[model samples]
Target: MPPRPPQKPNRRMRGFEPASGLLRDRIRTVGEARGFAVSRLLTHWAEVVGEDLAARTRPVKVGYGKGGFGATLTLLTMGASAPMVQMELPKIREKVNACYGYNAISKVLITQTAPMGFAEGQAGFGPAPKAPPKQTDPAIRQRAEETAQVVQDGGLRAALELLAQNVLSRSANRAVTKKG
Candidate 1:
């Protein structure tokens, strides 16, 4: 019998695919099932709407007409923020349309929940309390100051030094955590 050539596989194996790349199709399927045709609206809510609005409100779902035209975006907000969200409906619709690169959202509806919340937890609108300042390591503090010495302005130098110290401290923490 003549030797048979090795059969080629139908699909080639890929190495190290990104989580997002692999999950894209599944995410789309799930999102579409949940009435989110354009998942970016949900993923990039903060970008579509301003930070202030984003923090106070959360996109629940998008309702499309039978023909899939003139989508109505439903948002969940705390009872207190409902009035503010109501006033910004026009603005929100415009911004959402802008994100979709068309007049996709014709209406924006706000659903209010209790402060403590029920199914969906309350999205905090109040500013978080500031954390007490931590004492910086003296060596890190000195190194950051030395690095910022090139800056001419004293105020700018001080700010830069503080920023450097914060960055180094975070990186140091990560290293220590990884080692431990």
Candidate 2:
């Protein structure tokens, strides 16, 4: 046989795989078999259930009968909120089914747990405290007020001065924080 030229790698084949894309097939296989659209349900839990309910509960899994389709959704909730969630089962089921575009869920089973519910992996942390509003230099504030005095509207003049003051103050705080 004659020698052949070296073939270049296909550029189309080279691409980044998203973290989620790698697990998608596995999630679909396990989730669908159990009658749960796990990825969709988890991603849109807040939309499927109201914000209030979603905050208090987490979807655990779905169990289907031998016939299939009409599966029971298992939800994990804090003991205190379980009763409230129990009352809203019908509403939750309807919303979930709507997301699935069919009557995919027939029942919602509430499982109560300790106030600290199931941990997906790492422990959850509370939101950080907001930084306090920065204080502007008196000279800068005076200059901003004097410059904004050109605007005839009282509200506009005050707003302009305040905006300038805020921008300067925030920049000053950023510089100080970066130094420290």
Candidate 3:
């Protein structure tokens, strides 16, 4: 019997490429259409502007003027914070331009909005879970209650007691698991 010839490698089936690389052109096209070089400015806005400013403001879009001479950046901010952000326009423009490695933004436009206005379509991660209320040993509960007795406010005392009980229970469970 004759031996078979070796098979040629498949040219059409290329192995894994990172999603970022695969979508780079499309993302860049969309960003350019919006007068921005990259989405990194929008995505890492908190890093571009300080957390305090980022929490209060949202970058909406960039508009380029005729001949691409001057570009304006529009930001949406809560009504109460609009004045404050308006005053910081120069600083924000500098920071944003730095992100783009040039003086791309020539002006900052502030649009005041209600608290719920700008956040209308955005989804937020729900509130964190409350610590489990699993009952701990009687001794631990008694100790926590006694320690919280000095708290002047009834609400504060109750909160402290719950926190102490949760901590003690979690530590006890960890110790038991380690031993077993």
Best by lDDT: 1
lDDT of 1 by residue, 1-180 (tens): 999999986976688778887788988887788788788887788998989899889888888999888989889888788898899999999998888889988888888876567645465556668999999999999999999999999999999999999999999999999999
Name the runs in model 3 displaced over 4 angstroms.
Answer: 1-26, 118-180
Cα lDDT computed for each candidate against the true fold: 0.86, 0.79, 0.82
Query: Considering lDDT, which of the candidate structures 1 and 2 is the better prediction for this target?
Result: 1
Give a tens-digit lDDT track for model 3, residues 1-180.
899899996767568878887787887787777777758877688899998888878777899888886789988776777888888999999999999889999999987766555354242223446998665799889989998999999999999999998888889899999999
CA RMSD (A), model 3: 13.4
List the pairs of residues colliding in candidate 1. Answer: none
TM-score of each: 0.58, 0.53, 0.53
What is the C-alpha lDDT profile of model 2 across 63-170, one tens digit per residue? 887897678888887667778888898999998888878898898898777654456522132344799976679987997888898999999999999998887777
Clashes of each: 0, 0, 0
Error of 2 at 64 (Å): 1.1
lDDT value, residue 77 of candidate 3:
77
